[model samples]
Target: MEVAEVQKQYIRELLIKGRKIEAIKYLRTNFDLTLRDAKRLAELIDEDIADDEYIKRPGPFSGGGVAILTIVFGLVGVIMLGVAIHLYTSNRSFVREAEQTVAIVVSNPSQPVFEYEINGQTYTYYSNVESDPPSYSMGEEVPIYVNPSNPNDVLINTFMDRWFLISLLGGMGVIFLGVSMLVFFAARAR
Candidate 1:
């Protein structure tokens, strides 16, 4: 559950300044907290704090919670990066070992299709290649690398074809990593 607000600090400050009515008013106006809730909060604050010093207490979303969220984001980023790396390596390896041929491009609703020939046999593969306005035009010849054992497995040997997914995932991973590091450091500092 998400907290509506953090009024504890403000309430504590008001209590420290000996303005109980203002503290209660602030809680009611800002957080929509009931009188009982405001009084309860005031009492809790009074019990925990002394006259000279304010003891810092952990709330629902303490530093620990922030740390946990950081870990979760970091893990997701690592998983995405790992999958991207695996796909990139596998595609590169397939291109290096598979038979090279030229495929005729055909227009499709979702994406362009590739029609290629292998040992007098024609095979059609839906391209996963992403581009605005489509990269290959109808009747265009594109370089194709297909697995010898399983002809269905194909790869288009282009920078966008080979590196788009990897780049996207790697970029996301970097962003998550950066955010997690920043959150972790900030939480620690706090």
Candidate 2:
């Protein structure tokens, strides 16, 4: 290969790997190229790589659609779980009322953990299945229902936030249908 071409490749690779000193040394040794030229070449190569990679990735519209779908479906699961909890609480009375000033119960069906404390009492709780907290504090006030007939039998917290999960489920459904429609329409077009 030509001397200039060899120098350019070496400079480009070094800059991509962020080796400015080595690139400059080689540039000075092999080619009479200026420091500015070396820097410019490196920058151009890096930008070219960046631009190419960006083009290969999904665009904002389709990518954003997928993102929206993911969030929507996630929320759907959550909302459904909340609705189920609410129904169960209302029907079976899972929430507890304490004659004592402080009553502790698992945060609700919403949380996954070993225990949560309210007032003075500590309530032992867990998910229907074994799991750990999501690592972020996202739990809000969970509505709990208490049995009027019996005070001690409290643990009935209704999962009133069914809509949260519905959004997720609905989002997933929409995305799926959208993809399916796209495929169907494309097939017909062909």
Winner by lDDT: 1
- Evaluated against the true structure, the overall lDDT of model 2 is 0.49
Task: Tell me model 1's lDDT, rounded to 2 decimals.
Answer: 0.78
- CA shift at 118, candidate 2, in angstroms? 18
Ten contiguous residues with the weakest lDDT in model 1? 1-10
State every prediction's TM-score relative to the real structure: 0.62, 0.26
Report the C-alpha lDDT of model 2 over 4-29, residue by residue, as the tens digit: 76667766667666566787777666
Q: Give the per-residue Cα lDDT of candidate 2 at 166.
A: 43
Q: Model 2, 30: alpha-carbon shift in Å?
A: 53
C-alpha RMSD of candidate 2: 15.7
Clashes of each: 0, 16
